[model samples]
Target chain A: MIARRIIVLLLLLGALAEAWPAAQTLVLVVRRDSPVTDLDSVTVRKLFLGVPVLINGTPLRPIRNRSEPHLDEIFLQQIVAMSQPSYDRQILNGVNRQGWLAPSEAASVTRVAAELNANPNAVSFMWERDVAHNPNLRVLRVLWSD
Target chain B: MVRLTHSLWVRMMSVVLIILAALAPLLYLGVSRIVEDGYQERFINSVRAYSRLVADQLEALDAAEFERRAGAVLDGVVLSGQVVFAQIVDGERKIHSSITPALGAASPREDYTFGQSPDQVYYISHQVRRPDHAVVLRLGFDEIPTSERIRATQRHVLLAIGGFVAVSIGLALWLSAVIARPMVLLQESAKRVASGDVHVQLQSHSSIREVAELNLHLERMRQELVGTNEQLTREIAEREASEHKRLTLERRLLHRERIVALGTLAGGVAHEINNIITPILLYAQMALDELPASSDLRADLQRVVESAHRARNLVWRILTFSRQSDTQAPSTVFALRAPVEDALALLRAIVPTNIEVVFRCEAEGVQLTGDPNFVQQVVFNLCTNAHQAMRRDGGRITVTLAAEEDPGEPQLRPGRYGVLEVSDTGEGIDPAALPHIFEPFFTTREVGEGTGLGLSVVHGIVESMGGLITVRSASKLGTTFRVYLPVAVALSNAAGAA
Candidate 1:
């Protein structure tokens, strides 16, 4: 009976693990030396979608990450409000019109954070927990919470 | 009306005006259509660009942020003077707008289209897509201003057309003058020719070939007419000269016939007078012989015998003058001065003292073959006629006897002859009576004053002796009678053969 109870508890724990999502927080981050202190949701969305957003006459440069599919999906759903393929086509159109394009895809979260830390005007999104201990990066806004 | 139709200027102007009238309206309509089409295209492009700008701005915002700034965004579009009543609506609800209307009021069609409101303002509407909703943008424009611009352009085009037509008419008139100038000159020259002035010369220096050719032909005709007129004038002068010569000959023939008729009548009358006179002369001479000499009765008888002898001599003279004597007396050669002197002496006693008689014997030794009494009678009768002619304005009488050769008298043969001329300064014979002066009983004197037979008898005596007579007279000038007698040598030779 004690073994059967332990098996049930383990099974219930697996179901609970499957039922609850992982703790995922999308944060808008920039270099610590950036003039921007904070951004609204609309401004952050505008920046990712290749739309130019200026803070005190300074343009924000956005960076994208390719290593985390889950974070990318949440950002696309909350900020871009379009499918991945649709957003890619929009970016292509923006490139043809001589607008700004996302830089090279970041290889990892550390690389994304490092790119934000290197450029004062650069902006990107990452998990809040991953950036929590870093002092070299700034949290510009919260893009999504799950 | 007739003159107006004929004017070249008028006709050319009319044709130009008609063409302008026909083309003016068509040009206006085509220009107006092009202007309207171009303006409409430009207006549509501008409105579409405005709608696109509004859509891009709205699309970049969240629903909540769009609500906060929609009014400001739309107000900026409306202030651009291209839009009116811009609105952002989602489904049946209005989020923001330039102006508010009742909810659920149907928005205009969102596909770019034009409409007119009740106030007569023109508006265009377009639908723009936002992230969560569709926005309706209505743009109002004042059509009156654009229409006014179009009308002003139309008026300028019309004025330009009118100015062109006026210039064309003026050019047409100038062309007409250039073309018709030669014709006007030709008409004037032709009028002069018709009025008998053929000397008019037309100008041949014309630009038109036909007009120059016509002028050349007219010049040739004028030369021909001048030649014909000169020929006709010469012919007329020659005809008049011949006509005058013919009339002179006709008068001479009529005069000769009258003299011959009177001679025949005088011969018969003289024969009767001679027979009666012979018986009275014989009886008176026998009575005178019986009476003695040295007694009173004897002297009276002697006077009667002498008177009877004188009467018998007068009868014989009349018979000879009338050409009725049975025995013809032979013509004798005598000094022509003797008869002329004798005639002047007798005429001086009978003429009025107001008349002066002068006798001239130019040929003192000139001789003639004719009866001396007959020569004396011709001189006496011519002088007597001269004295009678001058009785009204008593003037001079002249008797001249001379010898001439080839006197050119038609009846006198071409030889030396004695000429007796009698002249008087008097009221001369009338030209109407000159031809009839030798006719028997054709006298200008009053009745019973003198016999018209005096000149006829003188003509017969002169002609029977182989001589001729002619007379000339003029009014207020004088009278002259010439009697031509044959020379003694020529008459004797003529008589010897006869």
Candidate 2:
């Protein structure tokens, strides 16, 4: 009986982890000094899925952030509109079919912010709060909400 | 059970089998552990090294194109056939190969060593660093083949142990036969020796030191036994020859003794008959003298006188059979000491060196009215019997002659006599046998030792000479025979005493 309670408690914790991201929103982020601004959800998704995108004829670099537990899943659901497996399949399919290089990845919000500052057209997903106090970073668009 | 215990082959084989039974299983277990351990160690080392090589390759990959070729790299890992599962994980993202890990087998758990998981998979992980992030590469190597190898090696070990046991038992059998063969041969030889074949040498060949030494001792014993048996056989043969001679002599002496006894009995009857005849003859003659010169009564008295005279002649003839005339020589007045000395001289020459003769003649002037041979014969018989009595231990034979007076016994009158006493410090006669000693054919000596007639003849001679003989003996002490004879000088005294 104790084991069943433990398992149910773990299931409830997992549900809360998935449900807690709903109050937060993920925005496409870049360096404040870069020319990138106001990118649409289509351009954002294309940039994260290993498709090369251009703004003012400048090549864009997409950075994947893994700072939060369900942040990537929220981003892939709202903007990319795909499950985790399907999104991974689509990105690997582009690398195999079109011979495109995979996008760069970062594990922490600080490393994501650092990559955007270093690259003039680098793009990434982060919580609104991460760029809220950073003067060097800016949000091009809302990547996801809930 | 008896047969099995007695058999050498069974005994040796059982010992070998027991040793093997104890050792073989231990040998199998130890060897199997070593073999399985060898396969397991090699399996774990190689799998871990292979997984490390894969992670290193990923670290060197082109980071800009890693995601596009990551699936191909992981697919290549699965194609190696040892990796039943392959995946690259970076935080919440996991990129896997096309292979579905064991095709619905039980889920693979991370295994730290060989045989840790029931899924027959060895799980290992290596971290590959990319320019942007690090991915952890994990691989599950198939464990079934290594397990199969271990099992096969263990089977081989078991078979080898079995073979060793069999070879050991075979060697024991051969060795036991080598030892038992010679012993069995020796047993047969011993049986032959027991059955009186002393000539059968105790021989058995063996290389074993103790057994060879035993054979040597047995052969020596057999040789000694043979020599002893031959010596015993020779002694028995010599004894048999002496015995044959003794029995023949005994038979002859027995016949002679019977005749002597018959003569002595007849002589006693004749003496009584002669006394009656003499009275009849004298009365008949006196009656004739008182009758008339021509009377008819004189003829009848003449016939009685003639018949009495015939009867007297017959008595004299019967007296001759009493062994006194066996000498067949006429009697003469001879110095009895001379012949007595001569017989003693002869006895001294013939007797063995063991006996000593001591002679003393006190009656020097005494004369005996008989053939000198009678005195010689009597002395020879007495001395010979004394010599035989002392033959084994070699004692003294004493013979003495003296003028003595006869004791007033029933058979002996009080008179002067020449007494010859023969005594010996030898094996004495039994007191029970003394009364019968003077009877003919009665003897205490063994067969062929004497005719048993010596004392009987001596008795007859002394009686005829107006003397008597007597014997006194004690068991193991000594024996004495005193013969009293009336000499010429004692004739008047003997006649008056009678």
iRMSD of all candidate structures: 13.6, 17.8
Off by over 4 Å in 1: A1-146, B1-137, B163-388, B394-435, B438-441, B447-498
* Candidate 1 structure, TM-score to reference: 0.42
| CAPRI level of candidate 2 | incorrect
lDDT score for residue B475 of model 1: 91
Give lDDT tens digits, candidate 1, residues A110-142: 888788888788888888887787788888655
User: How does each model score on TM-score?
Assistant: 0.42, 0.42
lDDT of 1 at B393: 77
- For model 1, residues B106-206, the per-residue Cα lDDT tens digits are 54422222233443344433343455545544444444555666678777877886777678778777776766677678778878877888778876467
Give a tens-digit lDDT track for model 2, residues A112-141.
888888898888878888888778998766
Docking class of 1: incorrect
